[model samples]
Target: MTRIRREVLTLPAAELGPDNPLPALRPLDEVHRIDGRERTDLPADMARQLGHEPLRSLLPARVRDGYGRTRAPRALDALVIENDRLRATVLPGLGGRIVSLVHLPTGRELLYRNPVFQPADFALNGAWYSGGIEWNIGATGHTTLSCEPLHAARVPAPDGGEMLRLWEWERLRDLPFQVDLWLPEGSGFLYAGVRIRNPHERPAPVYWWSNIAVPEDRRVLVPAEEAWHFGYERRLSRVPVPSYDGIDRTYPLNSRYAADYFYEVPDGRRRWIAALDADGHGLVQTSTDVLRGRKLFVWGSGPGGRRWQQWLTAPGTGGYCEIQAGLARTQLEHVPLPAQSEVSWLEAYGPLDTPSTGEWTDVVGAAEQRLAAALPRARVDEAYAAWKPYADTEPGTALAAGSGWGALEVLRTGLELPGTPFPESTLGAAQEPWRQLLRTGVLPEPRPGRPPGPTPVSPPWRDLLETAPATAHTEYHLGVAQWHAGDRAQAVRSWERALRRAPEPWPPLRCLAVADQEAGHHERAAERYADAFRDLCRDGHDDDGTRTAAVAALGRETLEALLRVRRTAQARSVWERLPAAVRLRGRFRLLLAELLLAEGRRAEARAVFDAGFEVADLREGAEDVGRLWNRLTDEPLPARYDFRMRPDTG
Candidate 1:
């Protein structure tokens, strides 16, 4: 089909009136653990240096009473870009985020439609939300401009189609960037052509990360499984994903506990990634072959991690998963553009609606076909080359002969691939167990891949350590296996050695922190969490990833450990020192307010509860707090005024 003319509707002021309600959210029980009670307290020093905080202290007090989303409907330049097959809206006033993408034919919203333009603390630049596809430009992590207005206008595509252009830069490191968006007429795909330029005279840094938020109830299919590599605090190791504690990752996301991974896609043929909704509707994302890194983040529908994120970004509406594609391997490893140079590439998002969603071949084959129409096929040798820098592949020597789809079948997959051997280590048999540790941050059940006798540890591990004895990762896992075998003291010693030798020591330190918290070493656990964050920063890993782990551990794990110990004063101190983003989180806000009431600070407590009324996810907390406030004051609760959706005519 030929390209058709596209339409761009401009709204001077968008209105979110009383009849509108957020789209039916995936139920919290789908992912959030309901069996366990929320933690009531935490210690003062929990996950100190490691955390997600605003770049500056000027973030709006997360506890503002009656706070409304910064992206709420108001009189600003509103843009609606549409075609026969797809429709999308861009809020220029709010950093030009796509806001919404709807499949017009089905009347189904493909993107997570956040009814409000709420900005909570998540991005490094301060203020981020959990919906719509976000364009992360400028310095690494979330750009400083995500929360601000951008220069947007409707332009013409070279193919005689219409384009929406968004550009923003506040002289951020002299890095100015521009993105041209196009929705082909009668096409299901949205294409973005981005240009990040070093506007200054001297050599300047360039970075770009494209993040898409998709529904989590379905399944995400990546190229590799066991071969999927992971990195934390800047150190990377190949690992299995979405699985740990014997849980298979292919199950529904919300059912799984919290897990995050920066993984590599090793498939050579498809050169794309996809997420298929339960009903077989799919969202496919692919970038220029050069954008090497891909990441998956899930706030396990389980209890612990969700509590921490809500405190930070307020994962409002419901929890969603992130599919992130970056221009480079990690945020810190930005390329230096030539003086006055500019780099540009294309990224596309399309849809899939096939009869079969459960079958990998059916789903991925469908997505690959649809994607191939707009992109080039992934080449096996080229794909292996991406891993060349990190792997042991030699240019002169050829990869082991054979290929197929998937990780274990990677060698047999037809698209063609290569192998990277690490020294003389026997990592081959121990792949699964090592992957488990990398993906879950916890060790996996010992694989009986070795002789079953006095020593149950896998034998490949022994070979790995033999050749890489000084390696921190090898030592860390040695500790994990020891700990898992009920050798806690020896495990602790192994981790200590791992920490000293590893360049990026967060994982080893994290193990220590968890052990301390579990052993009622609340105070020390808190200190370790903070120290781990510092170690992450010092290790040159992406600061944003470190912050995510820190916040989750400190807010959920460390805080609970402290509170269960009745360290009220210490918890309060932690609450105070927390970035405004964390302090005003729904759960923590409720805790802080309740603590204030218990401390006879009713006025401040009331304000804290009032903030919840403004957020849909936290609305339940608002009601309970109101009841408690009335009880303490011997008066009726104040009436809550919140916006409601006008009824739909469909």
Candidate 2:
């Protein structure tokens, strides 16, 4: 592939001229100025102060004319410093690496860039061809297009020396480009366009789109025939997708009148366009002719989060519409593209008087007519009707029901306890007894068998449990209630039953482990905890590894509890069976060393403590580990030292 180069320049436009038709263009300058202000000169004092810190010393200093000076710090040093500061302060602690710069204020950041091509292998090559494009306010109200070669920028050490190259293009026509506009903070209007000419002697096969992402809750109104395609995986599929892998297939779109729509255009078309609802909201349209067809895509951001860029619905979320100009899915095998042929043209007409619809055969014509028409009055009748149910309800019932789950029916049909053989009245009587367990620190006698006599006539719990064996959630809830009611044995049984029927592993594992721990089954509790940790680890839970370490720590605690009862031999045997990963953990190793010392094995204890100190030092990488080693080796404690400081504390 040939390398593609981008030309960067400021847009030349004065303030809106008297003859300009679009009055909304006047605010472009203000929006540009606002965005540019985010890139103001960095404070030199702050940079120097940060440079003195150990962890933050990696931040680079600002360099003036860095490229021409041979020994100067790279331009990327300033960028990295700025980004690191933003990550440590402005953004949540989650760090994001900067990738490409489109403009000073706007660019393609790896973590928070516009959802064009995701940062996949295909995107790496595609992004290089696309270049860094930005649209900002010009001297006039008109927008300017700024472009920069992504590879030209220099990065600092570590990441800087890596050989990252942009995709090469022989001619500019081989590249497809679009202008991205960052919207202002408040409600306003923005427009985007692409001017492409087929410089090739023969028409080039083309597939182009203006992908707009919106929030999940925002409703879209599009014209359709009998049914429209609904994207299952947000923007990829038109039907219900079984998994993320099956997102490529398109299904017939079917949605309420409020659902967004994607219009599929047949191949071999030249020009296509669409408009957005006129309330001065954003809109997007696309035209493509790769498979001898044209496709148009559109959607809106549902109600939530700040709206940033065009088609951006929320801060970190959005949906898309794909307008295709090609043969239908059925006719793909029969269609063939002419060599070196032009594909299609896409145009977006925003700030329309009404919502965009498929009913119009000529969208541009309809858009022009709508633009001439007066803006319609805002209506609240439908909204009022939707909210009428809450107003008409009785105050008592309304107050009692908090939300969807707090409805009267849900309250009346309370949770069911599993493995409990008791009447509703007997269960109710046990509530106070359960509460007494926590206060008095006493365990109730286990029931030998099922309770005597017939089951209670008003046993709502038995009916609910028997009828819905799969109600593991209810079983767990009831177990917690029983634990609080002073029936420790019954709580254990209930949690066991819940684990047997629970669909997922997490809830049941947690309930069972807690029940065993409370029931004085230390070894059994450790086993259950380990099982839960392993299961969660296999399922990609974030805290799985941490939880596994915690389980090992708990096992050590359990051993200490056993030793308190003079079961030293049993504790030693249990400790020997622990997993290697757990045994090497800082807390577990410390406990093991202490346990060896308690057994009067001084030399063995010394060895264990030495190993533990090394592990702790490696894991924590702090001076405290060295101090701990000295203390364990019989060095006198420091006079002012506080032994109670936490291991994790700096």
Candidate 3:
């Protein structure tokens, strides 16, 4: 019999600090986009879906960029589901990620269990940690819930065993989804049944990827001859698998930089991917045909890639690569789920015991044969069929609770999702103001001196705000909704109205600054940002970590805006006002160096770099450090600071 129990796993972790108290009015800035030239070779259907229902803004979800590099040992709650052959440890609060998977027979760990809980800027709403198996949903980027919680409970499995079910309402698409994990008695493979339901009356664009992290020093095999390679250069080109550009790409270390290879799995082939060690022992992940895609992402053997690996966890810890399965042929596309429909599939993860050292084809074939004997493809489909009825089973024994947004949606729309219940008991302070609006038709104001709570910009919330009395709180939230809907002019008007009666000017001023920047009013944007930063500092008591974090986060944007408009003196003043601890952060230190360079203090800027620091959340394709280093002096870029994701062609 499979057993489920709660436990704790201790690790050195950086705190995921308070969320940025601002609405994410625009999509995250990125230079790596699919341009027209890159789209020429894409299939018609794939190209069409790539352009369909793309992300515009991550609203209602605030940016979570307040995390820092400091870490201390902490105990995290975990739920372990195990039988005799394998033990799976899951973190319910961290997107219900499978943090550890150990095959009891060989005592071999099958997944890359990251040694630390270090939050980085990888998710859509920020604060993402690397490792184990993460369920990516919403859009092309990592899910917004990467650091957020998921409701977990015990539910009956198809084989009369207890399954651990993790469910949550994905706010981006307003869809409820669930993942059920179970292990059959005496079976080595762990089964995951995943479902995403479109409860709305209209079709909703959905994206999902089950990302599995495994040790990188292994040969990865996929059932395909060709793959679509997407690299940091922002182009997708089809190339032969196993060997690309004279190097065998299946061995992750053969590459020189980070990249993704989406295998072109033929229609009739089994959907699976595997990573095996030198002894042909590792993990293999497979799913039913509905999950159609398999991908391999590697941070290759380069200074930047190696630095990223060490930056994600502790030094001396082994590096890892990702083997992912998704709903589309490639992650850049989103499939439309029709109204009132759901997509469900079963995925299995377990130990592979096939010969790893041989010709590529022979290795994959042997693994496939071993897979057939251990858990057949037909068995996966059969498990899917059996799990469908159980997918609707009312959850029992609540193990963990997630955000209250889902419960608020249930209360507002009376949604009838059966297995994934968003009961009133889950609603809390975050949902309180919205609850008031739903009941009394008036959005309540925040307590004095504190920042306003999260603003919901969906159509329903927007409509409610439109009808409510136009106070500063209502108008500010209404402006956020307007901006999310792409009504820039109306949004500005609503914000201006909010400014007229606002208690503090920072909130509306910050939104207006974003508006000005988008309109190319750089000077005006800088002015507004400066004003907002000053006002935020004035209002903050600096007694609580949340307020201090807010001040530091807003200060970065203000300084950047000032520098963009060449307001060096003002930027210097802004830097001086920041707390000493905030100024010492690597990001702020880099900004200080930039400020010094702008002021023609090249020696000081160079000294800052010589002192050494690491920007913990340096973006994937960012070349800012290299660019600054070149500007300061024509010296070789430091290995620790080299984070270039591609070869330098310049």
Error of 3 at 165 (Å): 0.4
Alpha-carbon RMSD, candidate 3:
1.3
lDDT of 1 by residue, 436-465 (tens): 443444444332211111111323333343
Distance (Å) between predicted and true CA of 18, model 2? Answer: 64
| Worst lDDT 10-window in candidate 2 | 57-66
lDDT of 2 by residue, 70-175 (tens): 1212121112212210110010000111223221232212112332311100010111111111211112111111112211111111111211111111111222
Which of candidates 1 and 2 is the stronger one according to TM-score?
1
For TM-score, candidate 2 versus 3, the one ahead is 3
Over 4 Å off, model 1: 1-76, 226-237, 241-245, 250-257, 267-270, 304-318, 331-333, 355-366, 373-650
From the highest lDDT down, the ranking of the candidates is: 3, 1, 2
Q: Residue-pair clashes per candidate, as listed?
A: 25, 46, 0
Which has the better lDDT: candidate 1, or candidate 2? 1
Q: Which candidate should be chosen as best, given lDDT against the real structure? A: 3
Q: Candidates' lDDT values, in order?
A: 0.50, 0.29, 0.90
Candidate 2 Cα misplacement greater than 4 A, ranges: 1-493, 496-557, 563-566, 612-634, 637-650
